[model samples]
Target: MFHHILVPTDGSPLSGMAIEKSVALAKSLGARITFLTAVEPFHIWTDNANQLAYTREEYERISKESAGGYLDSAVAAAEAAGVAVGRVQVETDEPYRAIIDAAVERGCDLVAMASHGRRGVAALVIGSETQKVLTHSAIPVLVYR
Candidate 1:
């Protein structure tokens, strides 16, 4: 019953699998899929001084290009599966916030993503972005491991 589906990817193998799943599900349900990627802002600093630059146009351009490649792959996969798809990318320091915002802004009803399946020390070391999205998103999230 999903009209708009948001599929967030990091270009990882696990995220690729999630994209496949999302595409298949969308095809079955006759839903439109939105493939999204969040590029973290580039940080530039010196040894003595620290400064944050969020308005680097070149950085944003590169990020958009990188995200476009990933989104292109997702679109191809969905098209091959006979599913309608679109894409969106945003540059932000907070990836989770960017993803959730994009989903809401695009009017997506569901978010389908992959769990890296990190556990134990690894999980602790690198916290789960999927978990953060689940915690913060008001929309439904379906995680594929």
Candidate 2:
């Protein structure tokens, strides 16, 4: 049984599904849920085109806001399910690492995440974070596609 579940999301529809599935699993096991969001920093550009985009500070502000927006829904869902929930946001380009680190830091026993279920060439082209987590993480990962 999972006592603490770590749910990593990016606000995608698939991520939303993972959140719901995690909630149901948590509810069944009477486990608390911790939601972690990894937001990438504004990209560094070598050309003058970078001037058109927001500054680093601006980017962080907007990113945090958007990440919060994503986390809020999960919080609401957990509350509706009558489960205790916690939220964590980390700014990192590598979300897969962030997810694993959060699990260790939060003492979460399981990571429930959504998989796009990409196949072969497409899967290689668009790398799978879920696959990376499964490959690199010592903790258990339950992927809901």
Total clashing residue pairs per candidate?
0, 0
For model 2, what is the C-alpha lDDT against the true structure?
0.78
TM-score of 1: 0.79
Please report the TM-score between candidate 2 and the true structure.
0.85
CA-only RMSD, every prediction = 6.0, 5.3
Give all TM-scores, in the order shown.
0.79, 0.85
Q: Report clash pairs, candidate 2.
A: none
User: What's model 1's lDDT at 96?
Assistant: 69
Stretches of candidate 1 exceeding 4 Å from the true structure:
45-63, 117-127
lDDT of 1 by residue, 1-145 (tens): 7989999877777788989889989999999999887766555652211123234565556556766787899999999988888988776656667778988998999989887522211111013678898999999999887
lDDT of 1 at 80: 95
Quality of model 1 by C-alpha lDDT:
0.74
Give the per-residue lDDT digits (tens) of candidate 2, residues 1-145: 7899999877777778889999999999999999988776565662323223567677567667878887899999999999999999887657789889999999999999888422211111013777898899999999887
Superposed by TM-score, candidate 1 places the C-alpha of residue 92 at a distance from the truth, in angstroms, of 0.6
